[model samples]
Target: MSNGKPVYKLIDGKGRVLIPKELRSAAGMDYGDIVRLGVTNGRVSIRKIDIIEVGDQSPDAVKAYVRAAFKTMPDDTRLSLIAELTELLKQKKEV
Candidate 1:
């Protein structure tokens, strides 16, 4: 199965909300990365770290990442993956 989603537990006496190790690795978080807390639709969401959008990344890096992301898809998903990546690339370029 894919890595389970992050779940926050109560803060400890030291005022730290312990995050599960699996979640941490899945999100690629290292110590000292700033995390964001938010509430939407009455559900609390915690981002392990602030993500830099495509504008903050190199064009070649973005293309490579996109290629890698869609490389493993089964044949049935290749067309859909291409379409989605095209739209995503368009949106990122606009940002």
Candidate 2:
């Protein structure tokens, strides 16, 4: 395809487009994942709104890591982790 961009796909009767696999992978998207779509100047753009994976240390590394981790985690797991972290923070504050 031109400049490595995926070519067009026919939209279904229900107005859905099948996103290409390579494009999805490049954007870190997978099945069942939600994508954020935006329209600007009559053109649409997409971004992965939920994923903010941490790369090796940058200024906001911890924030990115926690954000990504939270996106895929179940509510129970998130609650447990938050509870643990809260306990640790409370201990630190008390010290």
Candidate 3:
């Protein structure tokens, strides 16, 4: 819905709904990934619990990757991951 596209999914009798791979992968989610759900205006929103890179081989790759990856991570995890990645990237550059 963020891109003005609508996604249709099926909710089963047991109150479970499966999110397709494309959408999940876009949000950096895979099997057993933790997600948080919230309701607003009678609509439910699901957010990924962590960041996962899905970028390609290109220039400014780390910058691009981190920005996109940060969008999906939970607030609590974002800063720590950024700090870790910053240190890692610095180390990579030093090598």
Candidate 4:
């Protein structure tokens, strides 16, 4: 898949397409990896999602990472996330 050649694939009845092993390797995708799918200009794109373990990070570092991530998120998603976090904090205080 890394040879700059296009590989043809057929979508199954359930609309699932099998990605070849070479293509997956080229994209650095492995089993159990999270992926984000999006459509742009009538073409579908797949992106590997990166997850950071905050348990091992310092509070300041985590905050900085979160701020940077929030900057990349859509305004609606950021607002929704803020609302969800506020609700969680309210519940925690009640507990």
How do these models rank on TM-score, best leading? 4, 2, 3, 1
What TM-score fits each model?
0.38, 0.49, 0.45, 0.52
lDDT of 4 by residue, 1-95 (tens): 67799999999999999989998898888765656577999999988766545474867546645765776799999999999999999999999
Off by over 4 Å in 1: 1-15, 50-95
For model 3, name the residue pairs that clash. none
lDDT of each: 0.65, 0.73, 0.72, 0.79
Give the worst 10-residue stretch by lDDT in candidate 3: 49-58
Q: Write the per-residue lDDT of candidate 2 for residues 1-95, one digit (tens) a residue.
A: 32676587898999888878877887788765645567999998877766534354655545555666676899999999999999999999999
Superposed on all Cα atoms, the candidates' RMSDs to the truth, in angstroms, are: 13.0, 10.0, 14.0, 12.7
Q: Between 2 and 3, whose TM-score is larger?
A: 2
Among all windows of 10 consecutive residues in model 2, the one with the lowest summed lDDT is: 52-61
Q: What ranges in model 4 sit over 4 Å off?
A: 52-95
Q: What order do you get sorting by lDDT, best first?
A: 4, 2, 3, 1
Candidate 3 — which residues are off by over 4 angstroms? 1-4, 51-95
**Where does candidate 1 have its weakest 10-residue lDDT segment?**
48-57
Better of 2 and 4 by TM-score: 4
Question: How far does residue 85 in candidate 2 sit from its true spot (Å)?
Answer: 26
Off by over 4 Å in 2: 1-6, 51-71, 74-95
